[model samples]
Target: MSIRDGGGTGEVAGRPRLAGPPTRLRAPPAASRPGVGRAAMPNAPPREFCTFYVAPPLLSPYFSVGGRACWEIKMRIARRAQRLAGTLAILVSVASATAAAGDADPDVYLLIGQSNMAGRAPIPDDAQGPLDRCVLLNDRDAWEPAANPLNRYSTIRKDLKMQKLGPGWGFAQALLAAAPKARIGLVVNARGGSRIEEWKKGTRFYNEAVRRAQAAMKAGTLRGVLWHQGESNATDPDYLDKLKQLVLDLRADLGKPDLPFVAGQVAKDSPVNAHLARLPQTVPGTACVSAEGLKTIDGTHFDTAGQLELGRRYAESINKLRRAE
Candidate 1:
C-alpha cells in the first residue's frame, strides 16, 4: 500500500483556528427559585441514583392561615418534588453507570463518513464470519458482537444493502492482533452519500456520531477515529474547511483534544482522491492512508479484499500515532 502526504499549509481556508482550552459543560443550577433551598429527596427510586432536590416553597403560610389552605400548599410542593426527584434519579443512575463503565481501558475507535466507511463492498464467503474479540455499537444503541457491514443503523439510505463486508471488522481484527490483551470496541456511525456540510456540529448526522461515540466511550477508551469520505463534496472548494471543523468538533465532544484521526483515500480513479490525500497536511493528529491499488467492485466501493487492506492500513496509521506519542 502507498501512502502520500500532500504538502500544504496547516491552515484551512475560510476557517478560524481553534484556540484556548476545550470548553466544559456545567451542570444545571440546583435551585431555580430564590430563597428556596434545595435538598436531596429521601427514598429516591430503588437502584437509581438521583441528584434531585426538594425546594421549600418561596412563601410560608402564616399561623393565622386556614389549615386546609396550608395543607394544600404543602401537598402541591410534595407532588412536584416527587416527580422531579424521580426524573433526576434516573439520570444520575445512568451517569454513574456510564462513568463506571468508562473506567475500563478498552481500546475504542469511531468509524464515520459516507458509503465506504459504512461498508458497501460485498462479503466473500470465506471472509463471512464473526470476530470474538470485536464489539460493535449496533442499531438499538447497544454494544453487541461485531458483524459484517459495520454500519447497519443508518436511516440515510434504505435501498442500500445492510449486509456486506466492511472494513470495521478487519480494523478490529488488526487492533486485536496488535494488542491481544486489550478489549476492542468499534463505534460505527457512517451514513452513505453524506456531504461534509451535513456533518457540522449540530447536524443530525454529526450529533448521532457524537452520541454513539459518547456511549461507546462508556464501555472503553476512545483511542482514535477512522474516516472515509469526500466523494460527495469532492467538488466543493470549502470541503477542507468543513472537514476541519468536523474533526475539531469531534475531538471536543469526545473530550479527547489530541485524539488520533485516520482518513482513507478514495479509490485511485476517484475525483476526490487528491483532496482526501491532503487530510494529513490540513488536520492535526491525523494521517491519510492510500487506496491506490485497491480493487473496487463498482469503481467506487472497495471489494472484500480491498476493505481488509484498508482496515489494516488504518490500524497501521493508528499504531504509528501511538508510538509517536
Candidate 2:
C-alpha cells in the first residue's frame, strides 16, 4: 500500500471506503430541523463525533502508509477552523464593548445656577420616576438612574432634605419625548439662595460647576447649560450685566462658545425675569423660559407641578435652539 499527492488532495491504495467502529449513529431526528430546534434522535452521537460516513463499517483500517496523506489533510482543515473560531470570538467581544459604552454613556447636560434650577419644589409621594434613557451624575460623581431631588448630588447644594424636584426632572422627560432614542445625563450643582455673582468665572460655584461638567463630559458630552438663579439677586440693578458675563465666561470655560444656555424665570415676580427675557438679545446662544402663571410652593419656590412645567418649557426652548443650529 502506497500514497501519493494529487494537487492538494491525496490518493490512497484505492478509492477510500468508510472505516470506523461498528456502532450505529442515526441521523438527527426531524425535531432537529430548523424551526423545531432540539435534536431528539436518541441514536444520534454527540455533534463532535464525526466519521464523514453515514454508517462506517467495522474496519480498523491501517492509518499509516496510504492513509497518512489523508490524515495530514484532515489536520490542516481542523487547524484552519480553530483559527477562524478565534477570529469570530474577537469580533463578538468588540461589538459587546461598543454596546456597553453606548448604554452607559449618553448625551450630557450641565445644570447650574440657584435653588430653583436645583429644584426646590416638593415632590409628591407619587411623583414620576427615574426617567428612561436618562441618568444623573450623583454626589460621588458617578452616573446613576435619574430621579426626583435631582440636585441631591450637587456637591455645593443645601441640606439634603431641602433638595427636592427641580427642573431637571421635567427637562429630561420632555427632552426624551422629543428625542426618544437619545439618552440624557445631567450634572446638577446648584446652591440654594446663591446669587449670580457666586457663579461667575473663578468663583467657587463656577469652579465646581466646571469641574463636575468636565467630569461628566468624560462619560458623555456637554449639550447645554440650564440656569435658574436670580431670586437672591433681585435687587441688583446690574444683575443682567453679571449674568451676561456668566454666560460668556461659562461658554469660554466649558470650551463651548456656542453652547445652548436655557435660563428659567423665578417663582417671584422679581424684575430678574425682565432681565432674563432680554438675555437672548445680548448673548449669542441664550434662551429664557417664562415663569408666568407658574405657581410656587412658598411664594419663593415653584411647587412640584410648576417645577415640572418649567422644565418642559426649558426643554422646549433648548430643543428649538438646537434645531436652529
Candidate 3:
C-alpha cells in the first residue's frame, strides 16, 4: 500500500514514542473495593488449557518423468507430466477463484488488545487448516496468521506452556461458517502489559499498528477492527472519556467513521468493576459483547475454549451490527 506523505513519521501526542506498559488502576487493598468479574465472587478457578498445536508449513510436490523407451516413451512421459501439472495448476486457480467468489467479500480484522488478545491456543497435530481468506500483517507488512494468540512479549505466569489461542481465530472461523462468501483478514497489534494510554497515537507501537491497519485498508484488505482491551484502564478514572476520544481519533484517522467496529467487555470481577468496564462499548458505532460467563482463572484472560466462544460472540456482534445497518 502507498504511504501518505508524512504518514509513518507523525508522533502520537507530544510523547516521542510509547514506552513501557501503560499505567493500569492500582489494585486496591482487600478491605476497600469490590473485585472484577465472577472469579471474584466464588469457586471459579482461572480457565486452563486442555491441549495445544503448532502450525506447520504447507508443502507442494515436484515431479520428474522417466521412461523405459529410447525416444518415444520418454517424450510421452514428459508430455503427460506437463499436462498433469497444467491440470493441477488450473484446479488450484479454480479453487481460489471459487473461494473468492462465494458471497460477501471477507474482511481483514485487526485484533488489538492486551495479553488476552495475544496468548496461546491448542491447535491439533492435523491443524494446518485452510487460510483461503485469512491473513496477518506483521510489523514489516508481511502476512502471517491473522489471529495468532501468543503475544511473544507477554509472559504467562503459570508453569504450563500457553498455546496460541486468541479470539480472532474463532471469529474468523465463525464468520466463514456463517458467511462462506466472506474472507477474513486479521492483523494483531496488541502489546502485553500495555495500558490504553500507552496505545495513544504517537507511540511507536501505536503508530506501527496504525500503519499496518491503514496499509491494509488502503490496499482494500481490512474490513474492521476487533478490539478487546481496557484491563489497563481499571485504574484510570478518566478512561471512559479517553477511550471515547480514542475511538473518534481512530475513525477520523482511518477515514471510516462508520467502520464496522466490534469490541468486548472484560470478564466480571476484573481489577476494574464490571459496571465501569462497559462504558467504552457505549461509544457510537461500536458494539460490545458481554464477558459474564467468559474469563480465565487468573481473572485477567479467557481460557482456550473461552477464546473460541468469545470469537463466536464477536462474530455475532458484528453480524448483528451489519444487519442493523
- What do the candidate models score in CA lDDT, each in turn? 0.65, 0.70, 0.53
RMSD of each candidate relative to the true structure: 19.3, 19.2, 21.7
For model 2, the superposed segments whose C-alpha errors exceed 4 Å read: 1-98, 126-128
Q: Write the per-residue lDDT of candidate 3 for residues 1-325, one digit (tens) a residue.
A: 0111222421111001111343433333343222122111122233411110101122011000110101000001122454446435544643443333323223666677766676554643333454545655544443334434423322221222453667777787888898865556566666656677776777665676677676556333456677777777766667667666666777777777766677677765655445334643567567777777875846777776788888899899888777765
Clashes of each: 1, 1, 35
Candidate 1 lDDT, tens digit per residue, 1-325? 0111133212111101112243332333443311112223464333332122221222111111011111110111334567566545544643443344333345788888888888877777755665666666666544555667667755353354654677787788888898876667788878778888888899988888888778766546789989889888777777667777888999998899889998888875665666667777998788888997899988888888999999999999999987876
Residue range 78-134, candidate 2, lDDT tens digits: 224554464355446433433444444577889988888877777877665666677
By summed lDDT, the worst window of 10 consecutive residues in model 1 runs over 64-73
Worst 10 residues of 2 by lDDT: 66-75
Ten consecutive residues with minimal summed lDDT in candidate 3?
67-76
Q: On a 0 to 100 scale, what is the lDDT of residue 74 in model 3?
A: 9
Task: Give the deviation of candidate 3 from the true structure as CA RMSD.
Answer: 21.7
Query: What's the lDDT for candidate 1?
Result: 0.65
